[model samples]
Target: MDRLKTLMDWFDVRLGVREILRSNLQGYLLPRHVNIWYSLGAVLLALFTLQFLSGILLLVYYLPAADKAFVSVERIMNAVPYGWLIRTLHMVGSNIIVAVLLLHLLSVLFMGAYKKPRELTWLSGFGLFNLSLILCLTGYLLPWSQLSFWATTVATDAAGAVPWIGEGLVTFLRGSPSVGAGTLGRFFALHVVAFPLLFLGLVGFHLFCVRRAGISVPPFGPSARPAGVGTTFQHEVHRDGIPFFPNYTVKELAVVMFVLAGLVAITVFAPALFLPPDALEPADPFTTPDHIKPEWYFLWAYQTLKIFPSKLMGLAAQGGAMTLLALLPFLDRGEERRPFHRPLFLTLYGLGILLLLGLSIWGHRS
Candidate 1:
């Protein structure tokens, strides 16, 4: 213990490690009224860290070349130690993280935590939400399996539905008119390098903004919605609020632990749920599967495209909806934060969520 303290003292002298911890860890504060839903933010952080680590371990045996990628993954599953476990965690964690991220965003929306002074936070977070989907899209192609190859084909084709630059967008993503070695190389680079870097930067900025603005007081409290102070008021840690360190941090960890347990359980008990039959087959460019569908996350959009009269219209509708979500704070500027206080918008939001869920299920079973 003494030796450890002496070593810490040596580094603390140069790095001020103790002060950094003191200020950022213990000194931070959060409203006591915040609930488990708020813990979803911490859950997301944990999920992302797990995905990042698992991806790195999988990368150790992963080959980026088109001809070798599927063989590499197959070898990882059969030859490398604990390779299947790491791959499952990375793949399953990708889906879980997106789900939790969406829930977190919805919680904030419902709580009206995206209001004034928190607008930037909301925008940055929304950007992360979209970026996470893109990360999934890029990483999906890295497997170079039949499922991934055709899914990328369908996705890039959707991108090609855009107005004038559609063809160019498709060429840029695929590096040609078709999915091949060029597509795999581009996606591998984006997944491993370009996209991850952008994600980390946005994550840093989101946390900073959240910390700067303070966690919003739950929509109901003595000081939560004081009369008409909504437009004028900004979220501030109450003087009587709890310290973020051991108090709220413990809650975050509890939630994260629960989530991690479920993730591990699913990975162990039902690995085949995600690794569908065709996913095991190598890319066969000369042949297309009878039914090609994206992973569940993109299913709602995919279903929407199929239901729409045209790909351009479906793409436009999706883009316009996302734009509204991005501009929500400005669009709904009002003197209320409590969700039920804004019944009409709340009802619409709930319906929107239900519709998306319905579409996803339809896409899956179609």
Candidate 2:
């Protein structure tokens, strides 16, 4: 312990590492009312770390070529020691991160954590959410199986619904006329390189905004609410409150560890759910699979687009919803942060959740 302290002291003298840690973490304060929901963001970072590390390992053996991708994945599952665990975790972790991200977003909504002065934080987080979906979409095609091939073909086709540049957008996405070698190469580049870099940058800015704005106290806390919390505009800066380091970091790590345990269990025990038989079949553009669909995270949008009178209308609706979510802080300038006090926002939030759930179920059944 003394040697460790001496090493830290030596580094701190030159790098000021101890002061940086003190200012950013040990000295940072969060609301005493903060709960598990607030830690979801950290949980997201943890999952992203897991996804990144596992993905690198998978990339070691992963062949991004259309002809070899499926065979390489097969070899990973069959031949490489514990490669199945890493691959399954990577695949399943992607979906789980999306689910957890949605929960974090909705929890922020429920608690009004994205209210005034923290708009930048919300915007950055929403950007991360969108980029995460793109990452998943690009990664979906990496396996180059029949499922990914046809799915990519269908998904990229939707870009053609854009008015003037639709065709160009589709071509740019696939890097050619069809989902082939060019598409695989482009998607591989995006999944491994482009999107991850953007994600990391956005994540850095998001954390900065969060720290600068300070954690928002929930409107609906227990009877022992903080002063000036009910109704009216309240500043987010907390001084005489729980220290975020030891107090909240412990809680944050506990939740992340618990969720990771569940994720590993799902990956080990139920790989079949994520790794379907379609994933085993190599790409054969001539033979389209029966009733192909996207993974569950996208089912809501998929179903919505299908039920629309026209593809353009469906795309418009989905695009408009995302725009609204991005601009929510500006549109919702309500002074009251309490859920009960803001009936209209609550109603809209509830309806949106119900609509997404209904659409997802419809899409799954369809």
| C-alpha lDDT values of all predictions | 0.89, 0.88
RMSD of each: 2.1, 2.5
Best-fitting candidate, scored by lDDT:
1
lDDT of 1 by residue, 116-178 (tens): 878899999999999999999999998889999999999999989988999999999899889
Q: How far in Å is the alpha carbon of 252 misplaced in model 2?
A: 1.0
> Candidate 2 residues 1-366, lDDT tens each?
999999999999999999899876778888777878988999999999999999999999999887789899989989999999999999999989999999999999887777777778999999999999999999999988888999899999999999999999999989998888999998999899989999999999999888776687778745534324344544466787787789889999999999999898899888888867787888898999998999898999899889999889999999999999999989987656788877898999999999999999999999
Give Cα distance to truth, residue 35, candidate 1, Å. Answer: 0.4
Q: By TM-score, how accurate is candidate 1?
A: 0.94
Worst 10 residues of 2 by lDDT: 224-233
Q: Which residue pairs show collisions in model 2?
A: none
